[model samples]
Target chain A: MIELQHVTKVYPSSPRPALDDVSMQIDKGEFVFLIGSSGSGKSTFLRLLLKEDSPTKGVIKVNDKTLNTMSKWQVPKLRRTMGCVFQDFRLLTNKTVAENVAFALEVINKPQRTIKRVVPEVLEMVGLDGKENRLPGELSGGEQQRVAIARAFVNRPLVLLADEPTGNLDPETSQDIMLLLERINRTGTTVVMATHDYHIVDSMRRRVIELNDGILSRDQSRGVYGLGR
Target chain B: MRVNFVLSEVAAGLRRNLTMTVAMILTTGISLGLMGTGLLIANMIGDMREIYYDKIQVSIYLADGITDPQRDAIAAQLDSSPEVKDYLYESKADAYARFTQQFQEQPALIANTPQDALPESFRVELVNPQRYPVIAEQFPNGQNGVDEVRDEGDFLDRLFSLLNGARNATIAVAVVQALAALLLISNTIQLAAFNRRNETNIMRLVGASRWYTQLPFILEAALAGLIGALLAIGGLVLTKILFVDKTLAGPIKAGIIPPVDWSAIAAISPVIAAAGVGLAAVAAYVTLRLYVRL
Candidate 1:
């Protein structure tokens, strides 16, 4: 579950607020699409949820824990409950696919047995079971993104955030990635995806929250991307 | 398992930035070596000061043509003087014997010296060695069979000051080199952090604590520092063996300078090592805090 109460974020270098007077609550296990144009506070919303940056004026609560007053030391614990997938599929290039997924567990100080058991399972779930030893650079764009997803999901975080997960993938590969995300959402992990892909959004018909010029424009149950533009 | 992972990360970081690591290690090693040299010189100066200060004396040499009465009067005057704690009358034969024994390593100098060529003098030790002027005034030269009144304390002062200057110069240079070494370490850590920003970002994203992301960089600098310290110790050992023990053997054997024994080097090695490791690790930690997010 995620909740934002009148969250307004204004970066010092920029004149306008990135997110202005935004109020929203996402229930547990919901698949939500955050629809917005560029610079419409989509990434800022995700960053706020991740606690990477704090809102200039607002409160954000993820999984019943208020993030506004969260101490610096507790940010890592907060991140442990959430998974983040980026457009670039930021895998360690020098590491193998298995090591990349295992790295998430390793950083969290998981036991060797757990890492060994969970890494391959997650890689297999992301459809890279046989490519454990391959480097990220050697993989295709879709395969690399799968590796990223495997890494994010390896810890079994409660919430998964995908920021333009299919931004670099072709249409067919993008649909496959969406199917994979939908599969993940079905396992009771709340998924919040931020994107500009209208075809994927219209076809999926999930809950859509649209942002326009840093303001909440529409919140529709099972909405399409271009409805309010 | 976590320990192995962290250690592997440290190893990979060091390997990835091999040239920077090598540069940092060499800088640290050279600086720590100079520091060790400075410490050794300080220890040697301390030993030499103790040896020379304990036996410092003023010598009033007699005129060659002086009578027995003149020599006896000079000796009696030295004995009765309040400034003189003790005095020894070294006859011509005694002076010649001491000179020959001191230069025994150079037999040519002793072979050319005649027994009567050395001066007969009274070597006077004062209670307060700084009161050399008082003794000198009491035994004015050219008056009471005293040809020259020389205060060994004066020569010792000049000599110790020269050695102190050398020690100070070496330490100053060492301090400068240490600053350069610290800067190099800071820059190297920053560069290493920059190069691995993507990995660290992912690590942070996946619930890796900031310390977990940073430990590898700190450990990399510390490992380089540790190796640098070992190299410095080796340099010091080599210098002692090659330069101090071998090249300066004559001075040490002749008692002109005290020998730099193994214990002195062994005593200061831990300090050098701690300095190398502590400075580098601290530099890296501080650089991470100030410049790099991780």
Candidate 2:
């Protein structure tokens, strides 16, 4: 489902490369957790996965297409296969929860019939049925994050790339979101989650890929977060 | 589905920026109004031109001291000229009789004038008003047995040109004002778009087509222009009734500018409306192309 061949990234005006010679892969339906410290290049990796930015050196193959070779115009088509959740939720404040999710479909020029049917179903999945009409500001932190998640998954993409889904949530709420991610994973969709929350990482015992200073330190199936400790 | 969703989003956007929408309306109103006034003035002057131009008469006054052959030669010249429409030669006797008819109440005063002492002149009408100069050019310094040739059109020509120039200047000033309004409208729309940069960026990320994002903004700009034009038209009508015909024309009755003609006002209203709406939409679209394109 995803492959990065020694991908290296250096943002303009930066002294050092963000992702230094990183190469990795995860099969279809695999749930992968990228655990790292504050500046482990986790977000950069996810950005490359979604084709928001390209690798300075090396190739990124997502959904069987070489991202480097694709023209600027083709980037959106590639992004259609993946859902993205930011740490801030990045939901349009002016739009209601339903409209926010519906926007994902709308941008793709989805028909009214599809919008009517799909929006409600996704809102239900995010446990935001009655709250659909409410704006993002009216929602709680967890609920807003849930709406963001719903917007990502509404399109039924092949991969869900979440930078930090549970970053702002309390422990109890974070676990519920993890459970939701797990539920989504069971539906035969690839899930790549990057998080600094070691407690959930250690407790879930999912496949883990560790990166330290832009280099992959370890890769384990049934991996543990506090492996060194 | 795509259209409905975009439209709903645009509606939501417009509602979100209610104050902005009203501002646009005001801006459009000002610009369109100026344009309308300029057009009305130009059209009114045009109508005055048509009316006065049709009745323009050319006077071929006879020489003060002339013989019968000279008079007959002048009559023959009038018949030969292509510009001549219909000529009436009022002889001294005929002139005397007509003068007496004009002041018939003063019978004793009319009795003192002799018929042969009266001035005989040929009242010449032209085929077209434009040909007055053509005939005048032919009879320079009374060359064709005519002692003095006066068309009465030279004064009218100078007056028409002066009025036309003034009206044209008003239109030019109005165009400049309209341009400024268009710029303001463009700036306002740009500000509206700038305020919603995050919304637009998100739409881009979500694969929104260029049209889906731009349609609402373009429409909003056009709406502003339309509002401005309507206000201008209304103000113009009020000004025409209250000021143009009522006050200004009354004060200027002794001068060159005439009373306001309703038909001229009616002629160019659509042009004003179209200019308003078109300018507004164009302003929005031009700004969007520069600022909104991803």
Candidate 3:
């Protein structure tokens, strides 16, 4: 579960707050879609959730842990419970698919035996079982995204935050990636994805949260992309 | 935390940036070598000072026509002088014998010297060599039985000043070279971090701690520094065997200059190694903090 109470983030160079006194909550095991145009504060919202940038004023709680009061050393621990995927698959080009996926557990000081056993199982879950040795450059866009997803899910984080994960993929590949995310969400991990793709948003009909100029415009359950545009 | 994983990362990093790593190692080696040389020179200077200063004496040469009564009067005065710690009266024959013994290796030089050419003198050792001027004033040159009074301390002072200058210059050059080495290490670390930005970014996304991401870079720099230190120790060992022992054997054997002992090199080896490792690791850590986010 994630909770934001009147969170407002203002960059010093900017004239307005990126997130203006917004409050929201999402329970566990929910698939949420965050839709907005460019510079709609969508990325800012995700960044605040990751604690990459602090909210200028307000509190954020992830799984009942207050992020504002979290010590600097605890940020990494907080991040460990939440998986993150970016628009750019962000895979290590030199590492094989299995290595990239195992990297997550490795950084957390996972045992070698666990890494060895779990990397293949997660790779198989993401449909990357046969391509374990292939480099990211050798994979297609959808497959690379799958690799990224597998890496994020390898540790079975409590929540998954994705930002424009399918920004570079074609519509067909985007649907496949959406299906993969849907599958991941069904495993009781809360999923929050931010995107500008109207087609995918309309097709899925998940809970839609729209942001308009840093304001929370809508929070609709089983909502279409352009329902109240 | 995993030793093999971190080590493999370090090796991969070093191999990935082989040229930079070599540059860092060579620069670190040259600087540390110079520093070790400076330390050795300082040690030698200290030993030489002890040897030369301990033997510092004021010699008062007697006149060629001096009678026994005048010499006896001078000896009586020297024996009662509070400034003199000890004095040895060397006759003309005694002086000639000492000269012959010193020049025994060069038979031609000893054969050319006449017996009476050497002067009878009192070799006066003072409590403090710096008080040579007091003895010189007491035993004036060209007075009574004294032909000339000279202080060996003056020549030793000049020699030590020259040696000190050389030591200071070597240390100065070593410091500058160390600075250059530090800058090269900073640049190399920055380049390494930049090259691996993508991997590090993903690592961060997966909750890798900042130190975890930065460890490989720090270890790479440290490993290079350690190797550089080993090279510097080797250079010092080589210098001692090839140059000091081989080239300066005559002076060292004659006790004109002190020998470069193996123990001296051994003593300063750890210091040089620590400097290499500490400076490179610090430089890499600082570079990461200032320039690279990951």
Top-scoring candidate (lDDT): 1
Best by TM-score: 1
Candidate 3 lDDT, tens digit per residue, A68-156? 99887788888898998878998888889999898889887999999999999988888888999999999999999999999999999
Off by over 4 Å in 3: B91-118
Per-residue alpha-carbon lDDT of candidate 3 for residues B1-294, written as tens digits (9 for 90 to 100): 877878888898899899999999999999999999999999999999888777657888999998899899988988898888888899999999877765666789888999999999988889877788888888788888799998877778899899989999999999999999999999999988888888787777778888888999999999999999999999999999999999887667767789999999999999999999999999999999999986
Worst 10 residues of 1 chain A by lDDT: A220-229
lDDT of 1 by residue, B1-294 (tens): 378878987888888889988999999999999899989999998999887777657888888998999888887887787887988888999999878766777898888888899999888889888898888888788986789999887898899899989988888988999999999999999989988898888888888898888888988999999999999999999998889988888778877799998999999999999999899899999999999985
Give native contacts recovered, as a fraction, per prediction: 0.85, 0.39, 0.66
Model 2 Cα lDDT, one tens digit per residue, B1-294: 356655665566567677777776765676566666666666656666665555447777666767788778777888998778888887778888867765565678678876676667787879886677777776665554566667667777797788778777776777777776777777777777876777776666665656666777777777667667778778888988888776675334533355666665566677777887787788888898886554
Worst 10 residues of 3 chain B by lDDT: B98-107
lDDT for A120 in candidate 1 is 83
Classified by CAPRI criteria, candidate 2 counts as acceptable
Q: Which should have the higher lDDT, number 2 or number 3? A: 3
Error of 3 at B16 (Å): 1.8
Q: Which residue pairs collide in model 1, if any? A: none
Show pairs that collide, candidate 2. Answer: A112-B1, B28-B228, B29-B228, B33-B232
Report the candidate with higher TM-score, 2 versus 3. Answer: 3
